[model samples]
Target: MTTPPFDPPSEADIATVSAQLGRPARNVLGIAARCVCGAPTVVATAPRLDDGTPFPTLYYLSHPAATAAMSDLEATQVMPVLQDLLATDETVRDAYRLAHETYLADREGIAVVPEIEGISAGGMPVRVKCLHALAAHSLAAGPGVNPIGDLALAQGDWSPLVCQCVDYNKDRASAGQ
Candidate 1:
């Protein structure tokens, strides 16, 4: 809490993240995690945006491959299965609840937003809404923090150890963005 537990993002990082997300990176406080190829994977965003918006997704998945993998899992309806696991497994539920608490603590360590005080992203401690958010947290905070996130990353076909980034700049240049 004394110092943020992540690398401060540079201008090139912002540019690369923008390209990864196919839009401008908004209020990214730092790079939470990086791929093996040194590309941004998880981005740490501000608890609040410049426009007074309460943004709760602190650790955001920026890598296209990672996002696509999470999307694929959602498309395959894996949320229900994970939700059931959360409902049935007491240990996992307890860990998930703890993860939610830690997430709130981490965010509040920066600044407390009354509007999003108890709310954690990815339907944490209750539901399995977004695998991307959960996976991002796991990737950033490392293993054993978020149970659902660990499970999701285990089930997903993507690997952070390998870089799956495509040159979005080249794609945009060829298509004239």
Candidate 2:
């Protein structure tokens, strides 16, 4: 596996991610993607968390706006639609399979957990289980890498190109709970 394409997290990044998550961001390896406001939007976490559990979600969406957007998309019952696309569109299936492979490679580059090997977040390769994970992967890898993720993101009301973060400088309401 090659080196993961992400920057090491800074103290501010850790703090921002913690605030976005409303809890301590444990075992965060790096900042995968950032919002337009420069706040951490996606984080790269350890394959195995500190407690030795096999946590396979390597790219975690942290920004409240992005998280909310993904939640809204999920609430719309889009997973089944995308899953159908995967079942019929060979091109989409091929790309999604590649996304799963890329996700695994990125995780293995950092650390490999035997229990989670061959598993990628958001039900990649075969299903569209979590928009949050898929969106996080899309943001971290950039567009065209994760087609389903990109499609889900396109369906969202929020945009990373514009800062939709809610009061990053002050305590505020979190969308989509």
Candidate 3:
């Protein structure tokens, strides 16, 4: 597999990702996607977390604005429509399946966990469960890999190209590292 399309996270990147998540960022292998302003938008997490829990979601959405936008789409019931499209459109289904395989390959390239074998995030290759995860995957992998992620992002009110970051440093809340 090609190298995971991400850079190893810096100290500041990890801290900012922690702040954006409102909790300590855990087991982040790399900065998957960043806001144009340089804050972490998505993080590449280890398949097995520090606590040894199996994490199927390799790309975790961290930016508050991006997450909020995806939440808005979910609130508006976009998942069912996307799910319907997956069911009816063979081309979409095929692309989604390829996306699942790609996700699995990427994650397994890092480290394999028997529990999450063949499983990918956001109900990929089958359903549309979490727009946050799907969008994160899209942002991390870039366009054309995940059609559902691309569609969710297109249907949402956010863009990675734009900067909508809040002053995370001002916040005092943290779930502890």
Q: Indicate whether candidate 1 or candidate 3 has the larger lDDT.
A: 1
- Using lDDT as the measure, name the better of candidate 2 and candidate 3: 2
Off by over 4 Å in 1: 1-3, 166-177
TM-score of 3: 0.92
lDDT of 1: 0.90
Candidate number that wins on lDDT, 1 or 2: 1
Q: What is the lDDT of residue 28 in candidate 3?
A: 93
TM match of model 1 to true structure? 0.93
Per-candidate TM-scores read 0.93, 0.93, 0.92
lDDT order of candidates, top first = 1, 2, 3
- Lowest lDDT 10-residue stretch of candidate 3: 168-177
True-structure RMSD, every candidate: 2.0, 2.4, 3.3
List, residue by residue over 1-177, the lDDT tens digit for candidate 3: 355879899999998888778688899999988899888899999999888899999999998878889999999987889999999999999999999999999998898899999899999879888899999999999999999999999989898988877533333235332
> Between the candidate structures 2 and 3, which one is better when assessed by TM-score?
2
| Tens-digit lDDT string for candidate 1 (1-177) | 443599999999999999888899999999999999888999999999999999999899999888889999899988999999999999999999999998888888888889998998999879999999999999988999999999998889898887776554465568987
Compared with the true structure, all predictions reach lDDT values of 0.90, 0.90, 0.88
Q: What is the Cα-based lDDT of residue 71 in candidate 1?
A: 92
Model 3: how far residue 43 lies from native, Å: 0.2
